[model samples]
Target: MFEKVDPQYLLEGVDGFIQEEVSYNLFYLITGFEEALTIKSCDSKVLFAQSPRGNPWLWVNRDLPEEERENALKLLIEYLDETPLTGVSSEPRTAEMFANLYGARYHTSIKRRMDMEAYACPQVVKPEGVSGCLRSAQLGDVETVAQYLAGFSEDGYGIVVDPASQMEAAEIMVCKGGLYMWLVDDRPVSMAQIAHRSPRHGRINAVFTPRNERRKGYAGAVVSGLCSILLGEGLVPMLYADMVNPASNRAYQKIGFIQSGQISDIRFE
Candidate 1:
């Protein structure tokens, strides 16, 4: 059976796991979110969590016997009986199993929304011959950043978003001091963000370079520069890349990121 547990329970013996595995579980590190829910199997082989801002996430310890893993998932579905969930995210197989069982129970159809590969960079391999240097984004860069944000959404996920609609988000990101720009000859050519810092790793996201700037190595330069900053602070850099985007994956790999695991995003319709 799965029982509701305090989020801190996840940290027990976490040191034994590599940072890549721990990155997916960082949602549990979010504290004092009244809407958050966390649960674990009695044997502690399976974990499920949901934060207000995201879909429910499942983590099944691969070391567990297959039969035990199946039983735990069954109990999890039962525990969530009638609970409304729009979707789930997890390592591919776990997400598929949970989505199938949950969809059957609710009579809903499941669709795979995205397949993402988690990556970690232990050492940065900055691209040479890139003229741009990394600088923290400021309020003056909001307009440019907004456009880049909109472009990132459309290009990376095929989502149509207006640049004006992203203005507020751009301002917030810039003000947070995590947003960065790769400036060449005083012009911003690429952008990236240090989305969040977990205990041992920092996540980089929103990497984008305009079509006109593509193939110029700006994306690699920006991401590698951010990785160096994180490393200076004693934190490893990690990010999730869309499995369908070979270009972005190759870029990250060129900068020293190693594929760690895969996560599937499934939606119920």
Candidate 2:
């Protein structure tokens, strides 16, 4: 049987598991969201969380017998009876299973949105010949950061967002001191942000290089430099790469990030 549980309950006994399967960091981080809801099986072998701002996420203990796992998923679907969900994200197989069942019950269509790979870096291999230094993004850099943010959205998702639309986010990130820029001769060339920090890992995201700055090793250099900083703080650096973006994935691998696992994002229409 599955029942609603406190979000904090989702973290208990899962620290080591999350450390090993870094892909589930989404599950770890979502619990902190203000409107997050969590549910787990009676034995706590299967877990699910929903965030008001994003798709629901599920995590089933992989060591369970296949039959047991399937049964738990079925119970979870029943437990969620009329609760509305637009999509689900989880390990590929689990997300597929839940999406299939959820769609069948709601008579909705299921679509795979994105195939994402989680990577963790144990070391940093700074790109050679990249003549840039990594520095914190300042308030004065908000406009540049906004442009890069807009470019990242367009390149990563094919969504043409106006740079002005990203100004507030750029200002907030800069004020948070988590955004970093790679500067060459005092000109910003690339950018990345330490999006979140968990117990033992720091998540990196929003990595971007302007179109004119591509092929100059700025992206790799900035990420490598950020990874070094995270490592110095005793946290492993991790990020998710869209499988369709081979260039970005290659750049990350070149800097010593190893593929830890895959997660599927599935939408119900």
Candidate 3:
């Protein structure tokens, strides 16, 4: 049976599993939004969270028998909704299974497959740039960061988001010293951010270089530098890249990131 649980209680129950797979679930659990909804089986074999922003996520123990997975998913569906979810994301196998069942019941489609990768700070070839340096984004850089974040959302996920909303998010990152920018001759050329860090895993995301700066290797430089800093702190750096974007996937690989696994972002339309 599935029952809703408090976030703290849920986190304690899944601590062991999440620490091992921290790269995947840290962002969802650490968002600090108390309204985030979590549900799991009585035996704690299956866990799901509906983020405060309405994103559904699932983590089912792979060791469970196939029949158990199906039953768990059925209970999740009943607790969440009888109708289709607007969007869902999870590991590739779970995503495919959930999408199949969701599509079987409603008119929905698989939106995208996001590949998650990790880097062990393997040697990186720093891009040839004599005038630029990576620096933490400051309050003065809020406007630029917001604009870049908006562009990133549009180009990466094809989602049009308000500049104000993006600014609000960027402000938080900047205040936390998590956002960084690559500056050339005192002008920002590219941006990246460290996000959702656990004790051992730190995620690099929101890597964006404006269209005019494309093909300049600024993004690679910024991300490589970020990885170096994260490694100095003794954390494994990881990030998600859109599978459809060959350039990004190639860029990240060149900087020593390897494909760890694939995940999916399914949208109901």
Candidate 4:
């Protein structure tokens, strides 16, 4: 059995479970889900949370016995009958199990993803002649950030996203002091964002360097700088990377990130 609960309440109930494999959804739950929705199993062993009208993700406690997971999945299906869900992001086993039992057609096959965390700052080597410093992105950088965000989506995920929407998101990030950039002669060359942050953890994401800036070490420099700052704030830096992208994964590893575990991103058509 499951019961609908306020997201604020769910946050307290699942705090320990989310730490098992902290991800964007976790940060969003903590930092941005004031108006979101939540549900938990009657035993409080499983949780499902989502942004308003957005896709919901599952988070099951590792200690929850196998039988509990089975029962929770059934309850989750019944709950979904009333609340539409377009996707699920969770540990590979949990997400796959839910998708199969829910009869949600596999819209996109599961992709292998790595969850990584950094304990110490990485030693970064700046390319010769690439001189600049890292700084928080200002509101004036919206155009540049928006363009790079769109390019990143296309290049990194092979998905086309609306530039307007990207700009809106970039504006929010800049205002929140979440966006950072590497500039040369006052011109932005590479950028990264603190995607989701908790008091003890911060996730680096949306890393991008223009094609002309590629291989010049800007991406590495910006990410390394961000990780160092997050560490200074007493927060462990973490990030997620597609296992298919060796270069991206290698870049993060070079910044002292070690593989923690794997998760799955599945979309239902």
Candidate 5:
């Protein structure tokens, strides 16, 4: 039996942030409609020692608590040792640079060396009724969207899991994201997610529509509309599309998103 975790208390430690088990999956129940959680998290693959030194980042938030923050770094360091990771990435949780992930120093280093490439941001249109509208999603829309996403299996992107598992996971993403859904006449349609919100940039997650819903000008509108909102909010928008899909690449191109970098998925032992 699982005891419901208190958000305030569980966020007290690094393990809490890395492997937070909430009462009712608040992130999903709350976000309305999100891109769904499909990242390669060891969240379910491994168990944590109560006082483990290292942590993992399950959620990306600026207002992370003290216990969770410190522990998360410890967890990140530990996890790095176990997994064959290329990018020793970390987020700037604080000002002191106690443990630098991708802090000011690292950014400065990359800048000074001229190793990092410069890139422009993507801009999506805003959602509204009539032409292009983005409304908050409901529980009922979950099944439909979930079914549509199953088509994007690991066979293609090197990320695979049972479709049923994907649906269960998506529930959590929608809630934590305050997700917004696109609809037509009472029927749920396309979906987009908002994340990485900040002064520098905001990331867009899982912009998708059903296979049947494709070519109807839905995705173009959704991506554009969402990007527009982020731009309006003074945040540069970014996203990664499967390079394999020429159609998708074209869609983003139409919206003014330039090629950022070569994102690869390496699954090896």
Candidate 6:
């Protein structure tokens, strides 16, 4: 039923879950390259809803009636009820009670939204015998950057993948930016993005450093550089740190990032 988001995007999330051979160039109507909530309705109906800081998040877009959206939700739930699922936005506080908001009912029981940010910059933390440089990422750097992301750990956020996660993961990374900087040998040790649709918002993403390269200031420098890039573009950068990783959060605070509020989400049958 999906008509807009490239089917390839939808399949990537699916591949992440099924861990099977994924075919490309497939577009989905509602679900795109990111994971879509997989639900096979046994008892309760499920919904997949989307929210954006703005319009450009959707590459090719369309709109449907509120009732149509609701029906789509009901159908999607019925279609994929057996699968574990997730949504990608900060849930509204009153989300659970609403029958329908954007395109789906607010599922209060679903897991809370993972951290999304406007932009974030960590305070300066000087590292001895180290130097860092930041700049926008380019096509030439994709292989190197991909290698770094391939090794990034969710650090305890429950996001993990084997060697198989490469394709879909890579596709999502491409939508990001050609503007990322690397530290030391011009390899991207940390990478983030300033949102295109929102002038005041930025997102820190794919901030990875090789395991052998951890504890150095490369991460901070790369993120700080990305923040400066966003600022230069006249935007404020925002990002989320794992509540569990006090060190990561603290590093950001040292570099001038502040916590506005915690984001929570949920789902229901």
Most lDDT-accurate candidate:
2
Winner on lDDT (5 vs 6) = 5
With a 3 Å backbone cut-off (N, CA, C), the pairs that clash in candidate 4 are none
lDDT of 2 by residue, 1-269 (tens): 77787786776775246644589887767888757889877777788898877899888888878788777888888888888888999889888888888787789887548999999998888889989799999999999999998998898878999999999999999999888999999999999999888888899998999999999899999999899999999999999999998999999999999999999988888
Q: Give the TM-score of candidate 4.
A: 0.83
Candidate 6 structure quality by residue, lDDT tens digits, 114-228: 4322224333333345576767666666666556555664444555655345645554556565446555775556665542323235556566667777787677777777677
1-269 in candidate 1: lDDT tens per residue?
67887766654554324543644845534433555777777666677778777688888887777777777888888888867888988888888888888877789887547999989999999898889788999899999999998998898778889999999999999998889999999999999999888778888989999999999999999999999999999998999999999999999999999888899989889
The best candidate in terms of TM-score: 2
Q: Rank by TM-score, descending?
A: 2, 1, 4, 3, 6, 5
lDDT at 266 for candidate 3?
70
lDDT by residue for model 4 (1-269), tens:
78877766775656456556454335354336677767778776787877776657677877878887877887788766766667777777888788777654324443433322322233333334557889899989998898898888888768888777798877877898878999988999999988766656777888899888887778888888888787777777777777667787777776677676566767665
lDDT of 6: 0.45
In model 6, which runs have C-alpha deviations exceeding 4 angstroms? Answer: 1-130, 153-160, 171-179, 195-197, 267-269
On TM-score, the stronger of 2 and 6 is: 2
lDDT (10s digit) by residue, model 3, range 1-269: 88888776765555336533643554354334677777778888777777656667777776778777877777777776753467767777777787777776666776655555433334555666535899999999998999898898899768988877888887888998888999998899999988767656678888999999988889999998998887888876788777778898898888887666566767766
TM-score of each: 0.93, 0.94, 0.82, 0.83, 0.52, 0.53
lDDT of each: 0.83, 0.87, 0.75, 0.72, 0.47, 0.45
**Model 1 segments more than 4 A misplaced:** 14-25, 28-34
Residue-level lDDT tens digits of model 5 in 76-176:
44544443222221222231222244332233222111011112354553323335577765666666656645655542345555667667656766667
